[model samples]
Target: MSQFVIIGGGVIGLMTTLQLADAGHEVTVVERGECGRESSWAGGGIVSPLYPWRYSTPVSRLASWSEGAYPELAFRLLEETGIDPEYRQKGLLYLRVDDEARALEWARAVGKPLSRVGPEEIYSREPQACPGVEEALWMPTLGSIRNPRLMQALRARLEAMPSVSIVEHCEVKGLVGDRQRVSSVETSRGNLAADQVVICGGAWSARLLELAGLQLPVRPVKGQMLLFKARPGLVNRVVLMDGRYVIPRADGRVLAGSTLEEAGFDKQTDDQARESLKASACAIIPALADYEIEHHWAGLRPGSPDGVPFIGRAPGWDNLFVNAGHYRNGLVLAPASTHLLVDLLLERSPIIDPEPYALEGRVGHTA
Candidate 1:
């Protein structure tokens, strides 16, 4: 079995580690901070892309596969680790308050069964919504998961693996080897050897690759999100209004998000972004106007020129692989990404083509 050293301990890294360990490979996760505290913890936990069908076919296929894998994974993790990821199937209710033509076309393109719900039906489904809302597109298969809990459960599962080791507060500085192959990683802790090194550092992917004398064209897109104290049943399902979304959890807390800013690695919460999200949330469900805002934070999504993530091996390097640039869909695509990467590493046929997710395409592809 090949010994694999994975950089970053976010959802992608942890999930990949789990899959590798399950395949009986020796794995070690080197994390800069506590596991899963980065973008994985800060994501909205939406199980699909903002618009699944509008994305590339490869992206849609991977997302769909990951969504299907989530239920079984959640159940197994809950049973083994005694922690629930709160995987809910409440479905997504997308309101087309402005763009009816585009919404209908997108719905049709996705091939998912969608029904146009009038204001009365929408109100009946979610009474807390504001008046003057025209119609909504209901996609019943879409849902969300609690990110923090999922990360916690993944950490517990990884800890239980006899062949997996986690070294926290271990920031990777650079790679140690020639241009053709990487033999070890230079971390703040020390030099650690590995048969192969997979970089899953999320927003920091490009910089990490630069240390190995390769430039990955990944940018950090900043997103600010907020949480509100909501009553159970206040919002029965996830609501998408224009570009904003309000997600209700099993607990009484509602997630009001988010603003996508082209800020490079700036994770500070801005007051303007927070207020704008609040305004957008209140516009969708006016009852939220009175709800107390619980928390406000920001995260950096590793965005590529195109929406597709950069997976597979970096060009010119045989042993160095990359799995970053997931951007906003990292949580939804985690399972399929891990499955595909493991298959590639073991020389097995992947469920989908790995060409679209290749890292070399990042520099040339424009979206």
Candidate 2:
């Protein structure tokens, strides 16, 4: 079996390690912080992009594939670990304020099931819905999973695999590679040899590649979120607008988020951002104005110029690969991203076309 070392312990790294270890490979994941507590834990947990049409083809394909795979994965995780990720098909509702025609066209082109709901119908479905919402585009098949629970389940499952070992609180310094392949990874602890190395470092991916004198064209986009305690079913579905969203969890906690600031790795939550999100949440569901604020936090999402994650081999090194720069959709795209990159590593037929995600012509240059 191949010995693999993955950098970064967010959802991408953990999920990829789970899959790799399940396939009989010896896998080790190194994380600077606790596993699954970065962007993966900080996200709203929607299984699809907030506005699917606004993204690139690579982003859409990976998202679509991962969306399709979530059900079975969630079921398996629940059965194996007894920690339900709370995967629910609660659907997504786009509160329309212009961009309707573009959204309709995108739905048609992508063949996603979408239906227009009037304001009255929307209110009837969700009495807490905000006013001035003329209409909404409903994608009933879209859903969400409790991301922290999902992370818990994944990490638990990975821990159960003897082939998989996680090294946390250990930062990866750099990669030691020759001209053709990466030989080892230099970490805060020590150097570890690997048959292959996958950089699932999320926003920190670019810095990791700098050790090899390469850049991955990925940056950290900080997002602040607010959690509210409300009655269960406060918002019946994921309500999205203007790059912000309201996500209701299985519990009574309603999540209102987020601000996409290009704030490099600063994950400190701002009071101004919290107030802005509260305003948006209240505007969406007026009753939310009365709910108690539960928590506020921020995470640094991996942002790329094209919104497409770098998910293939590194430019020069034959044994090094990347699966980062997912930005806001890391949770939505983790399944397919891990699948495609692992398929490439295993020399198996990929489930999705890998061209758009290839690294050869994209961001990274030969080192």
Candidate 3:
């Protein structure tokens, strides 16, 4: 069995480690901080991208597969660790902001259920959240999971595996290898030998790959969000207006987010962003204005130029692979990305065409 060292302990890294360990490979996760505390934990947990039509075809395919896999994954995690990821099919309520025709066409092409909604229908469906809407599109099969719970369950499940282990608070400094392969990775603790290494460092992926003499176009896109404490069923489902969204949890913690700012790894949450998100949330659902702002934070999404994640072997280094640059949809794309990366590692047939996600030119591709 190959010894695999995964850099980054976010959802992507943990899920990939699970796949490797289940395949009977010795896996070790090297995390800079506490596991699952990065972009994966800070996301809204939407199982599908906000506007599926605007993304690339490769992203839609990965989201399609992940939409189906989430239910089973949640069930398995609950059964094994007694922790529910709270995978709920709350559906998506898209307000009339953009052209619905493109969305309808994309939904038809994807074989996903889409229906037009009138103002009355919108009010009837989400009276508290979406009071008045001229037009809307309802994707009833869309779902979400609580990301924090999902991460906890994943980390617990991985810790239970004898073949899987974790090393937290240890940052990877660089890599020491030759032209043929990467023999080991240099961490803050020490150098660890590895048969293969996978970089799932999310927003920090590009910097990590620089050690291998490859410069990925991946960069940090700061997203600031706000959390509100409301009563249960206040914000019934996921509500999207313009570019912002409000995700209502089972416990009534309404997550209102976010702004896509190219701030170059700035992780601070300012009052400007917080107030803007609150205004947007209140505009979408009037009741959200009354709730107290429970939390405000920011996360750096691994932004790619074309909004598709890179999941393939790195150029020049045969033993190094990358599964990063997922941007805001990493939560939705995690499962399929893991499958494709593991397939590439094992030299098996990929679930989807790897050309679109390949690191060929590094300009358009996500890797």
RMSD of each: 2.4, 1.4, 2.0
Candidates ranked by TM-score? 3, 2, 1
Instruction: Estimate, for each residue in 1-367, the C-alpha lDDT of model 1 and write its tens digit.
Output: 9899999899999999999999999998999888999889998888988766557787887898998999999999999899999899888777764555665676677676666888888877788777777878777888789999999999999999899999999989889998888888999999888999899999988888887777887889999999999888888788888778998889868898888899787899978988899999998888898889989999888887777888898788889898988878889999999889888888899989998898774543222
Q: How does model 3 score by TM-score?
A: 0.97
TM-score of 2: 0.97
> Model 3: residues >4 Å from true position, as ranges?
363-367
lDDT of 3 by residue, 1-367 (tens): 9999999999999999999998889999999999999899999999999988888889999999999999999999999999999999979999865778888988888789988988887877788865546888898899999999999999999999999979999989988889669899899999989999999999999988888878888899999989999999887789898989999999989999999898998899998998899999999998888889999999999998888888898987789999999988999999999999999998889888888898877733223
- Lowest lDDT sum, 10 consecutive residues, model 1, at 358-367
Whole-model alpha-carbon lDDT for candidate 1: 0.86
The residue pairs in collision within model 2 are: none
Q: How big is the positional error of residue 89 in model 2, measured in Å on the Cα after superposition?
A: 0.5
* lDDT tens digits by residue: candidate 2, 1-367: 9999999999999888988887889999999999999999999899998888888888888999999999999999999999999998978878854777888898998899988998787877777887777778888899899999999999999988899889999988878878678889999999989999998888999898777667778999999999999999778888887667899987878999999898778888877998999998888888999989999999999998888888888787789888988888999999999999899999999998998888777765535
**Which sections of candidate 2 miss by over 4 Å?**
364-367
Q: Sort every candidate by lDDT, greatest first.
A: 3, 2, 1
- Clash totals for all models, in order? 0, 0, 1
Reference-based TM-score, model 1: 0.95
